[model samples]
Target: MYKLKTKETDNSVIEFIEQVEQPKKREDAYRLLDIFAETTGFEAAMWGPSIIGFGKYHYKYDSGHEGDAPLVGFSPRKAKISLYFATGDTEREHLLEKFGKHTTGKSCVYINKVADIDEEVLKELIKQSVLFLQERYPGK
Candidate 1:
């Protein structure tokens, strides 16, 4: 596997976000930065190339695949915003229903526009996802 260039929790990610072209996207990114900072109790920093991540967790699997990654984070991709929760939450389906226009993947929640969703509800979603991961993975 190619090695992750930035050492998992570096400020490089933050710098990358401030440089996004779209004004709305930049504002949305900062909003996420504030929310994640408060919720995860870890300072918001960049993870990898373009992800705004909160906290850090080193994980090891029975198969010996072990490494460190952000506990909670999101990336503003070209198509949409991708948020990583690190665990599967069945109840998240309920939130997404009222979350306006959005999509869900295996362990991520995606939103096209921040205007299409409730900011408060979105914060709760992040909180719940982080808690679920904490319960499953135990500490970062």
Candidate 2:
């Protein structure tokens, strides 16, 4: 059995943000917190040690692997901020075309700073991720 490490915990999101070493990243974390919360309509919660996540869904893979995860989340990392969104959504890719300056991984988008990306596109990503997960998982 594979173990998942990024489970939601009772950790404080504010405390985590305050502990961010870089002042600029700390400020961007605050801004992103507000954006994700407002856009997703879900309260922020700590996902493991770093990610500030909103909403949640449980996914079971074809290999029988399953776990609960946030619908949308972001982390202010030492290198850059990582934006988590739904994978396999075509619309997500389309939106990213206009997402300002950012790089994408399988499911995580990396941005240097909040100011480097368009706020409106960020909101759209949050919205699309939440919707995609809700539709895919359907009330998990």
Candidate 3:
């Protein structure tokens, strides 16, 4: 059986942010912390060593893989900040069109800094991701 590695832990989100080598990235992490918390109405928690996540949802795939994940999250990384949001929402793609300087992966958005993107669009993305995940994984 495959086990999830990124389980939630009792780690300190603030302490994790403080360890970010880039002072600017550390500051942006704080800013993103506030925005995601306020927008999603979920408390930030540590996911693995790097990801600061909010809320919780349980997901079981067709292959019988199951685990819990955060509704939304972000990691202040060395190359760029990674924003984690639920996939499958077309609105997420639409909002990313106006999200400014950012790149996308399967479910992560990479940004150089917070100032490089529109904060309002970030908020919208957060809102949409939370809604999409909640609907997809109801009761979570």
Candidate 4:
């Protein structure tokens, strides 16, 4: 199992977000933090060096891969913000239509800025992602 760096609620993450270089990126990070917190009913934390993660779950795959991970998270990258919906590839593309202008990873949705996306739709997508994960990995 990978060591858990911070608790579900940690101040380091807040400090990191505040220290982000770009004002626009920092603000967008805060917006993501707020929406994710409300949607998941969990506070945000710094997952590692830069990821502002919300909520968490521990999972063990039948293949023997097992570990604890954040339920959803986002990182303020140089060119965009990456929001992690672990179930993105598993099932969540339907929401992408209304996700506005954003790139995607197997488990992440990358947006240049919050303004470039629809907050309302994004919020719903976050909520949906959480529900989807819960249904897929309930006890985790």
TM-score winner, 2 or 4 = 2
**How would you encode candidate 3's per-residue C-alpha lDDT over 47-73 as one tens digit per residue?**
999999999999989999999999999
Q: Residues 1-140, candidate 4, lDDT per residue (tens digit)?
A: 55546445455877888788999889888888888998888877777677777777777788776666788888898877888885634346777887789887766788899999988888877787777777767885
Worst 10 residues of 1 by lDDT: 1-10
Regions of candidate 4 where Cα sits further than 4 Å from its true position: 1-11, 88-91
Q: Candidate 2 lDDT, tens digit per residue, 1-85?
A: 6999999999999999999999999999999999998888889999999999999999989999999999999999999999999
Show pairs that collide, candidate 4: none
RMSD of each: 2.3, 0.7, 0.6, 2.6
Whole-structure CA lDDT of model 3: 0.95
Compute the lDDT for candidate 1: 0.76
Candidate 2 C-alpha error for residue 126, in Å: 0.7
Residue pairs in clash, model 3: none
Each candidate's TM vs. the true structure? 0.84, 0.98, 0.98, 0.86
Off by over 4 Å in 1: 1-7
Give the residue spans of candidate 2 off by over 4 A. Answer: none
Error of 1 at 125 (Å): 1.3
